[model samples]
Structure formats: structure tokens, C-alpha cells
Target: MISFELLLGVAIVAGFVGAMSGMGGGIILIPALTLVGIDIKHAIAVSILSIIATSSGSASAYARDHITNLKVGMFLEMFTIIGALVGASITIASSTRPLYIAFGAVLLGSWAALLFAGHASWHASTQDGFTRWLELEGSYPDQALGETISYKARRAYYGAPAMFGAGLIAGLLGIGAGAVKVLIHDLIMGLPPKVSTTTSNLIIGVTALAGTSAYLAAGLIDPGLAAPVVLGVVLGAFLGTRLLVKLTNKAVRRFFLVVLLVLAVEMIIRGLRG
Candidate 1:
């Protein structure tokens, strides 16, 4: 059995990465827990609970700093919630191999898309009537850039459905789906990277809440495992929020991509071996 201290340490690292990248710590936590002899299903459930802690610890700070776009987060939440419930239900009946493969596949796809999009030169999209009506635009003070950055979101019509897909993957994999959410915000909606990440942080908590119901109903939530993870992630997430706001967009993107690539390969290999 994994020692409580060891699990706490792992959770802390997972939380920090999750908060920094807006990819919920579950991506890291689930793999670590499974390696420690925990069942994937239970690891997933514990990770889901920890996601709420990560969001709670980090999202508030981002919002208070005005880095999070509340309007965009709210609009997208509607789709994500519905999708999360459905995805969690599917996970209950699914096999672990496919879940691992799908988790890795999604991360790989997001990494590729972001890499192609490039690190610099993020421009606001030409807003259509629909996007303009939805008012999916905002500005934030970027501590890294030392200026106020203003941006307009475009293609809400597409972003909504994409977010649903993100939420589905989140619930299915016990990841916050923040990576996929960030990709949608950055690529489809044309939001800035900082905005994409911060807003993703805001959206993930609610998505997790929706997904948690299914797990709870199925009696998969183990309080003994979840307690240490939640406590550790909250601490790590608090630390991550402090650093993320000070980092440059390019730096943040680089960190995100590296983590994604390493985890993607690891998960895929594990899935294939099974």
C-alpha cells in the first residue's frame, strides 16, 4: 500500500501542475496512484475529488486578480456540466484500457494543436454576430507582459460543442479536462493563453461537481484515499496560482506542452501494454 505521506507528496505535485497548466492534477495523480497499486477506477474517483480542491485553491485567486474571464467561463459551463454527467456514467461501465488510451490520445491531440498554433502571436478573432451577442470578450492585466491585455472571443457556436467534448473527456478520465478546455479557449475562441488557462481554472470546478455525482451514485468515492489528496492538492494549487500569474505566456505554454507530451506517452504505453 502507498504510504499516506507518499500519497500526499504526490498529490501536492499533481496539484501544482494541474493549477499551473489548468489540466487538473488527475492526469498526474491517477497514474501515480495506479502505479502504487491502487485500482484505476478508485484512483480516478479520488482524482475527481481532488480536482475540486485544485479549482477551489487556484480559481479564486485568478478570478480575484481579474485574469479569469467570468463571462466565458459561465457560458461554457452549461455545456460542460451536461457532458460531464454523461461521461461519468459511461466510465462506470467502461474498461480501464480504453480510458487510459483515450486520456493519452486527447492530451496528444491538444499538444499537437497548440504546438501548431505557435507560442507567440495570438491575435483576437473577428467576432461574428453570435459571438458579439454573447459578449465573449474581456481584458486582463498581465503581470508577465507588464500591460493590460484585451481580447475578443470568436466562434462561440463551435466552442460550446467543443467544451461539451472536453467535459466528456474530463468525466470519463477523471481529469478536469482543463487541457482540452484551454485548447478550445485558445484555438477555437481565440483567447489569449493566460486567459485560456485562467478561465479554464474557473470552469473545471463546476464540471467536476457535475461528474462527481455519478461517481458518488456508483459508490466509488473512497474517503480514506480522497482526504490526503484533497488536502495536498489544495496546498499545491495555492502555490501554483501565485507563480502562474507571474510567468509569461510563452513560458506557461512551454511548461504545459512538456508536461502533456511526457504524460501522453506514459499513459499510451501503459494502455498498450495492457
Candidate 2:
């Protein structure tokens, strides 16, 4: 049963997950809370609110690093906001089975692509000249070069679809959609890890709030679960940020993928049981 104590616990955890993934809190909180007896719709609403708080807090720190390109984030945010509203509307009216399948499929596809993709450890020495000719360069830090690295960003045009899709998924799934945003920033937009991760964080805060509004309008939001999830996630995200200094995203992403696979199977099983 949903209770004040349970709500608080989930909120704390959600905050931590947000800090860690910029958008992973919902992926963790939703299924867990639903399993405990809250309706999936209500669970999603709580997850959405927690996402806003967590993303706002964690992304603020990323902004300080300057890797979050405000220009790109603001530009893409327009589409994401619209997509989030549409997606959340659908979620309130649909079953989650389809969303679970889609989430797993995207993760599976990303895993496969990452496996075959060969990324050269290269950065553009200048942000102008050739890069300007092609409109591809962006700035980021290169640990290997021990200084700021400026590189041309390729395939920025391809990012629009991905951004739209991420927004939809976030709203529909009550998740922050950072996983897809990071993918687009890193793969499609050719952003560095810092740039991609931080920029995704910068975008999620607003995106989540937009989604939260949609859920609230539908009266699917639950203050009981939301209260604790919000509290927990904000604190958790802060802790996760500190842990980021010690871990590689590759390791973190890999582990998250495995966990998702397991959850997908579990969701499938639970559905079958019902």
C-alpha cells in the first residue's frame, strides 16, 4: 500500500537516481511502486514530479562546467516540450505494456549500435575554419589533451527526430528520457561525453516539468508517492553527482542496460501473470 513512509523512501531514491543518470529515477521508481500496489498511472505521475526536482538540481551543477551548451539545449528544448506533453497525454490514456516494450527495444538497439560503432579519439583543434565551413564544431574538455577541445559536430540535423522521440518517451513513460537525449547528443550530434551528459541534464529539468503538468491536469498525479520520491531523488541525485567523479559513464551505462533488460523481463512476466 502507498503510505507516507513509502513515499518518502521512493522520493529519496528517485533523487539519487536522477543525480546519477539525469533521468533514471523514473525507470527505477515506476515499476517498483506499481508492484507495491499503487496504480501504474499514479506511479508515473509521482515519477514525473520527482524527475523535475532531481533534474533541476543535478543539471545546475553540470551547467557550471560549461559543457551544457545552452544554445543547443534551448533550441532542442522547444521540440522536447511539445513532445513531452503529447507523450504524457498518451500515457494517461494507454497501457504501459507498449511503453515497456519500446523502452527495451531502444535500449537493445543502442547496445547493439554502441558495440559496432568505432569512435576515434579525436577532437577538432579549432572551432572555426573547416568546422565553420561544415557547421560541425562544438567545445568540450579532452582529458587526454589536458585542455579544452573544440570539435566539429556532425549530423546535428539528424538530432531533431531523436530529440522528439526522447521527449515522447519521457512523457509516455514518466521518465526523464535522458538515455535517448544522451545518445542523440553523443552519437547524432557528435558531442563529447561531458557535453552530451551535461546538455541532456540541462534539458531534462524543463522537459520533466512540462510532463508533470500534463499528468497533473489529468489528475493522475499522487502527492503521497510524489512527496517521498521527490525528497529521496533530490538527495540521491546529489550523491550520484559526487560518485560521478569516480566512475566512467561507460561502466555506468553498461550496468544500467543490464538492469533494464532484467526489468523488461520482469515486467513481461508480471503482465503475463495478470
lDDT (tens digit, per residue) of candidate 1 on 205-233: 99998888889889889887888888888
Per-residue lDDT tens digits for candidate 2, residues 5-90, read 77667666655654564446777777667667777778778888878877777678667766677777887798788889999998
Give each model a TM-score: 0.84, 0.81
CA lDDT, candidate 2, residue 86: 91
Clashes of 2: 21
Best by TM-score: 1
Residue ranges of candidate 1 with Cα displaced over 4 Å: 17-23, 107-117, 144-147, 240-266, 269-274
**Cα distance off (Å), candidate 2, residue 223:** 2.0
State each model's CA lDDT, in order. 0.83, 0.71
